[model samples]
Target: MIPVTRELVTGIKLTNYKDFIVEHLEDCPKEDKLSRLKHIWSMPKFGQLPKKPTKLKLLEHTRAYLLYLVSTTIFVDASQRSTLISYLQLLRDLDEAGKYAWGAVALAFLYRSLSKVADRESHFSGLATLL
Candidate 1:
């Protein structure tokens, strides 16, 4: 472990900027993080969004970059830390279905897009293979 003054930073040592960003999701304000994530995911593609986004694409290459922020974070160990855990849990729980019907919408959009793409592009026939 790299020794600092007070806190003992665990996990793999950061050798670059991407490593630092990936390892520090708990440093930012939860609301700000969530707001940024939601803002990025707010795009509405109707049935045409084969692979769009749920919030503003903070990274040009990654659609749900905030998901990286969230996914990289772990709250199960710190179950009593803050309300952010609750929100994260809810978001996690939104796996199958939830209050926000966004998943359902996205699924339908994805199926439509995939069907259309497979029909037009023979090379992309296996929709799952494209992923």
Candidate 2:
């Protein structure tokens, strides 16, 4: 079980995330910057996507869906509006992504979030659904 650290999560800056989106997504926005809590293909944009997408679009959609899932559920933060795009890096190769110890990472994040609450944080984050 590996410990989750700031570097493991928040280390990837927004610029890097934007760069990744541009490099990967064919339909990436020309602005090349992430909106407040919204990434290029955020959850809200899912419905607008083509029903019959190409292979690349399917992969992109899958990645976007997974990102929404993790950001809103397991690794959720206080704002709940934005997610650390660093997770996308791991999601690049879905097959390889399964190799990660996701449960351990979620547990570690939950523990960390709980510890912050003990230190006077007003709101609880992480996988609060477990509690």
Candidate 3:
């Protein structure tokens, strides 16, 4: 087995962002988080859900939106947050597959952006290897 380095763990940490979103799903008000998530999701794509995102898509969207909120409304200096914002925008504009890909890419970008604050070497490493 490949040794689990901090580099590997960073990707794992990025996934935690999804969990964070799920945990805070109530932050957005649209009946509930799942409803808002489905709405945000279906806006860009019209098809069956992906196996990975079927249940988790809303939480992920919540996570992405939170990232936007923090990067813009808070004191965090996230230069790369725009990549995530752009990814979300693309999700709103692009077709289904493209939106899905952008969703994944948005998380990767947000992770890289956050790593700039907490861990630099690990952030870029995560971006190069994870996404």
Please provide, for model 1 over 1-131, each residue's C-alpha lDDT reduced to its tens digit, 9 standing for 90 to 100: 21123322123432343323333322333243332223222223121334654443223223222233332232111222222222232332233213443333333434665676678842322224223
**Model 2, which residues run further than 4 Å from truth?**
1-15, 27-41
Compared with the true structure, what per-residue lDDT tens digits does model 3 show for residues 1-131? 12222221112223333443334432332333222233344333323434666445655454455444433432133333232222232223223322233334335555766677475444332233333
- 57-92: candidate 2 lDDT, tens digit per residue: 888878777877878777887564765657777678
Ranking by TM-score: 2, 3, 1
Clashes of each: 6, 0, 0
Candidate 2 to truth, TM? 0.74
Comparing 2 with 3 on TM-score, the higher-scoring candidate is 2
| TM-scores for every candidate against the unseen true structure | 0.20, 0.74, 0.22
Which candidate achieves the best lDDT against the true structure?
A: 2
Runs in model 3 deviating more than 4 A are 1-53, 76-131
